[model samples]
Target chain A: MSEKQLHEDQFYITGLKENNTSVIQAIYKKFVPKVIQHIKNNNGSEAEAQDVVQEVLITIYQQATEKKLQLTCPFDAYFFLLCKRKWLNELKKSSQKEVTFLNENVSKDESLQEMVFQTETFSEKQALFDLMFQQLGEKCKEVLRLSFVTKSMEEVAVKLGVTYAYVRKKKSLCTGQLTQLIRESVHYQSLKNK
Target chain B: MQEEMYFAFEQYLGNEMNLEDRAAFEKKLLEDTYWKESFELYQQTHQFLKTKFSGETAAFKQNLKQIALENQSNKNSSKIVPMYSKWFAVAATVVLFCSIWFFMQSNEPKYVEYNQHEKAYFTARSEGVAILKEAQDAFNTKAYESAVGYFEQIPQANRNEEINLYYAIALLEVNKFEQAETLLQAIKSGNSVYKEKAIWYLGLSKLKQKDYSSCKQLLEVLPESADDYNKAQEILEKL
Candidate 1:
């Protein structure tokens, strides 16, 4: 996040954040073919390859939005690595048989590795947080949802027909309660240990 | 005790604490590992909630899904066409040769024997942009003039080797000989998967223009690595 220079490919991230059509089309045209080939050569179908590419792009969009991701390497290298890893993981999850992968053109650049690591971690944590958040009580869910969505404590209080102080207290307690729920989960514990 | 601590957590985050209380809270956070971790998790949970409820997430996802669907349909359509036509070409060649093998062997090879160009597939590459779909449709239907018109709409920078090859073929079909040869020569000089195909098409253009000596010269140099080297040799013998 410090003085490391941003690559020229940062336009892809910004275009994703803004949901630019031409940029997305450009990404598909320029980068998706090699990934499809890699997947097809390794006992995967074109449909599976398409899903992997789409899922990776969505994860990248989420990471870019939530974490303000900056690219230090070529987008091609970063994106291909992410898709290849995701496809391999998918293969492992679906089968118990030992899978020998085709020789991949993996980049060993330190910054690219570091960037992939960060994005993967971010996706995992976000998934866990979403799961825990869904387990909160109905009342707590309502309070937190309205508080964040309306983005104003006073408005939320009026909508809920409660006092400002009550909404304020509930917002804090509900968030704290959600955090406590996450901390006590086995998934969170494993993530923290890792 | 826990409620008060959580209250203090909220107050500290909201910037509602006095200077002295804020100082105490900061010191406690530094010294107390459990409190610091809880506070950090609390902040992250808040950020997650903020983003989850934001307007952009749903809109972005919907747009992405739409784009993916369009791309999928385009891929399915474009993929099926070339594969089907290629197999059809092979089958037609087999059927025709089986019925007339003795008669055709003695006659001079006609240009029609080798004119089964694979159908153009530009939609997937163009991704529904520009005039690629129109060009593909026109080329597949043998409307070479219209195909040439649509191909000319593509900007120079957007024209890759495949696009140029297809465009040059359309030009040759419509008898725009000089322009077609110039483009085919440029493609032949460049390094790409389309290079060999470009050379083959250049030879075909010469054949169409009745320059059999030049066509013979071009076909003679078709490398063994080319997919159409056998076809080139067949044409070379007849020429």
Candidate 2:
């Protein structure tokens, strides 16, 4: 990743991570109009287009925060492709009838495809982790939540009325259990296959 | 045993293991794919939890929702801008060039086009001031040189800003730029109805002097509330 040249538009990712208002507004102004038009062309409404754009941005923010997502292609192409794929998937999910999918000339750039894939994978894994987390026992869920949400293990212990050593040990065990549950899921298996 | 392994994973990640134990852990991971994958997943789970609980993520989502709402509402209000077809684009270009052509035909702002100053009215203000009457008549008749001469003869005590404004215009018309600008500057600084007029004339004085850059600079400062603002814009575009 270091060997590949980072595009100058990487500032979009940085702006997103920083949650800068003007940058987000610029993204909406410059790139979102194209995405909205595409979705409108593909049997989607303006409200649905807004949802797809917001979801794509949230996924990008998550990936950047967790995995340091680097952009090699222009942000416009990458962002539009992500929104398009998301809207298509939404169409596929909601339409029980035969829905005609318009296959415009999506970008053929290898790097753009790879970047979109990475973000999608990250989003799927996040969803899987959230689902698996909810399925954990109440004790484990409480321990994990307090462990992460608090500033430190000591704070977790103080909040839960447990000893510091117990909180520290419970944090590891709960995370481990969560990881095992994720790996055993069909979703994780399918993601790995992709 | 599984619980103890997770504890070890935590210690390894936190760098709490001694050198010998750390080396042994690394060797086992190198030799065992199961242990290696488990360790990787454990680390990833830790990162996911960190990001999930982060305040920054929540704040980012809140900001994104706000911005998206604002953008959507603004878009709806404006309605979609029609995608111009090829012919539409060509038509727009033609209109644009036509306006530009007409604009270019209206050449550089001439002093005469804007120099139709209102007729000086001093007949009532100072009934017995003979020289004020002379100044007003000379200015009204466009005898600006003699207007300047008559204005100079008026006593300083009787010479009010209104009279001074007329004197400055006479100076400007007769090409006495330094004295004209000085008097206009004083009235421009004073609080009077003619303040804005003084500013407009100052711009015109610069224009008549063929000082295009300075003229543009002065005209650009004319506020929209001024009566001459639209005229100033026309000169500005040509300049």
Candidate 3:
């Protein structure tokens, strides 16, 4: 796997990481036309296409940073899949009239399929974690938040008026508690099994 | 998980445990796959938090907004201003109708009428004034060959936009089209007083070269504030 050559689309990912406006603009100018046409052909308005494109782009950026996303396929195919998935999800949530894009042919590219699967799982895992984090007790949330933000248990302890030992113990317990909450959740098991 | 075991896991992962304790933790991990999985999740969560909630998140969002702003700026080429007064709105509608009607009546535009170069004059002081004056007078008198020869004599280290502008125009006058186009492209890409003029002349150069499509494209994008925008647009509409 490591013998595989890096795709030229890596330039776009690097550009996104560095927030180069020209590269981002180039991505839109080059790759977005096909996505927009596809949306319009399926009865979506230009406004909806724009919003979908924007959301999909932001997701790519977020996943890139959070998961160190790699492009094993051409960026266009991966981006199209993401936008299509997001639009399909939207169609399901809203009672929007049926979109016919399900019949559209995607390339039989295994690497692309693997990447799409990883991205979808990563997205769900992120959403599940965020939701589960909110379900943590205030104390657990505070300790974990402070420890992560501060990067030092000593500082967190001082900020929260606790002993160094207490901070260390509390940080572990809070993280452990958070993990427990996640493991006990129904979504966590499905995620793990996936 | 027991508090002691969780604390041991934290200390082991955090690298705060003593070497003996670290060995003990490793021994426990080999025996207990559940702890290994738990540690893996803990490390992933740690990484996720670092990315999702770190200081760079704000910058990332800000950059996205900047890109969005840049994207929208292109789409903002045609903007509709709110005309609140009834008379003002009616007047605007009438003007729009008149322009559309006017455009429909016009014949195919040609570039020859708009391609004529205005005479150029330049000034300089100190050591450069002699050659600068010679070039300027030569250019003024339509001796393009001697104008280019004299202009090329000045040492070319500085980023003087005015000099570059004159030099480029001289180059164009003498049929040194490639050199002239290079200078015009530089000026167009730079922040300078001659930027718009460079664009106009670049278009004219292409027009002279009979590259009608690019000439029309460039002329169509000249902003209203540019010196020759109206003429460019006129030539553009005709083309």
Could you give candidate 2's per-residue lDDT for residues B1-239 as a string of tens digits? 88888999999988889999999999989999988889999999998988888888889999999999998888765654465366678999999999998788667878888898889997577734787888889999999999999999887777788988999999999999999999999999999988988899999999999898999888888889999999999999878
Q: Fnat of each prediction?
A: 0.59, 0.85, 0.43
Task: Give residue A66's error in model 3 in angstroms.
Answer: 4.1
TM-score of chain A of each: 0.84, 0.91, 0.81
The DockQ ranking, best first, is: 2, 1, 3
Can you tell me which runs of candidate 2 are displaced by over 4 Å? A104-106, B79-239
Between candidates 2 and 3, name the one with more favorable lDDT: 2
DockQ of each: 0.35, 0.63, 0.28
Clashing pairs in 1: none
**Candidates, ranked, TM-score:** 2, 3, 1
The Cα error of candidate 2 at residue B95, in Å, is 35
| lDDT of residue B98 for candidate 3 | 93
Candidate 2 lDDT over residue span A102-192, tens digit each: 6633668888888888888888888899999999999999998777788878888999998999988999999999998999998898887
Q: Kindly report the docking quality category of candidate 1.
A: acceptable
Q: Order the candidate numbers by lDDT, best to worst.
A: 2, 1, 3
lDDT of each: 0.85, 0.89, 0.77
* Candidate 3: segments with Cα more than 4 A from true spot: A1-3, A40-51, A66-68, B79-239
